[model samples]
Target: MLQLREVNIDDKQTFDKYITKHNPQISELNFTNIFMWRNSYKFRFGEVGEMLCLISVPDNDEPFAFEPIGAYTKEAFIQAIDEISNYFKEKNWKLVFKRVEEDKLDYFKEYFKNGIDITDDRNNSDYLYLSEDLINLKGKKYHKKKNHLNSFTKNYEFEYVKLTDDLIDECIRINEEWCKKRSCEQHRNLYCERLANLEALTNFKKLKYEGALIKVNGKYEAFTVGELLNSDTAVIHIEKANDDIRGLYNAINQQFCENTWKNTVYINREQDLGIEGLRKAKLSYNPVKLVNKYTITCK
Candidate 1:
């Protein structure tokens, strides 16, 4: 028997324990945003023993149920859906599922084939899939990336350090500088809150073992933090570079992929959020593939 329950960050120990045991990379998702979102919006939960399951539905909508953040067996997923459907049916609201990632298409396919309307929302920008086997480029492609890295390394001492409280503070300073120079207009408060949450989480040594900081000329220039999504996948949560430094972004990005994620078969750089410049930057990497996502609504 499965039961659903809402999550509270006050119980961070239990929440973090589950994340570390099941999926540590999803640690980024275990933030105040999720807590606030779940608080304002009612979510369905299924509990089996110590394991807790989550299913999100729009607060304004009564019938729709979004998928859970944690992984589960196909049978468990289906059972969760059935439970949500029954609850929504009683409320007379049509059920809708949004932002289903491409990897989980089979789950939606099973239900859609039975007569549910599925639509590709195309909400996210192109996702880049990096090959684990670093491209063996001998000519232009190889030279271009090599030149930038070499130039960055020669001019600035490349230092890859474990993420620490001091490193995070430096990252914040660099990020604020970049934002100011770029005249970033959106999500200023949200960004600050997210960074604060990230800083707080970084203190958990076990959870943030993979995060790194890149310093140039003994000064913080860039930083990135991420974790293994699964056995073969690593997902980058946050990456920022000093805007004043030339090629710092390229240098840190390439180095991180070359060093930290070299063992992983695939690197999910994640979504670009439909930002034009960001989309182009991600596309420029020449991803091996793209993961398409979709949304489903019952008519």
Candidate 2:
């Protein structure tokens, strides 16, 4: 039998255990975000013995529920969805599953059918397939990217290392400077709060064991952290670069893809969130394919 239970602060250990056992590399769904958003949201755990399904709902929202961050078999996924839909219906709520992954679209469509209204929000995530064989690239494409990388390497004597206590302070300093210049209140506030929460930051660092930090002239300029989605895939959770530099963004991006993800076959850069500049920047990379995310709203 399948049952849904609310996830509370006490369930942290269990949640982390589930993540560690099933998928250790995808750090985006770490306990930090779950705890950070816990008060503003509610988590429901669908369980059948050792298997589990997680669903989140924002405090102010009633019609929609965020996608489950954890893993589940297809059968368990459908069962959980059905049970959750019934629960929502009882409460007079129309459940909408947000950010449904492209690969699971068919499953959702087949199961939800006429009961749920499916909509493609037109947002897409770009993913790059890494190849250790540099010879696979076309002459023109290969030359262009190589030229850009070479230029950045020659211009900046930067170092990429694991984010440590000493270097994290530099990342905050650079990030603050960048935010101040742009007058980005939202990012600045969130960054400051995250920094102040030592435990959360520590947890993030722990989860991002393979994260990289880029320093130019011994000063932090950019940083990115991610986890492996699967044995062959790594997903970047956060990437921030010094906006003052000309090619720092491109350089770090290329470096991480080439150097950091050497063993992985694919890199999931996550979504663009419907931002024009973000969309354009992601599009310029010439992604191998776009991961289409959808939302299903019950009528």
| Positional deviation of residue 244's Cα in model 1 after best superposition, in angstroms | 1.8
lDDT of each: 0.59, 0.61
For residues 134-198, could you state the per-residue lDDT of candidate 1 as single tens digits?
33323564576567666777777778777765566776676666666655547654444445445
Q: Over the stretch 140-231, how does candidate 2's per-residue lDDT look in tens digits? A: 64666567667778998998777666666666566566666666655744544344333334455444445667888877788765656666
* Number of colliding residue pairs in each model: 6, 2
Q: What is the lDDT of residue 257 in candidate 1?
A: 73
RMSD of each: 4.8, 4.4
Q: Pull out the clashing pairs in model 2.
A: 25-227, 25-228
How many clashing residue pairs, candidate 1? 6
Reference-based lDDT, residue 168, model 2:
61
Q: Which pairs in model 1 have colliding backbones? A: 3-45, 3-46, 3-47, 4-45, 4-46, 5-45
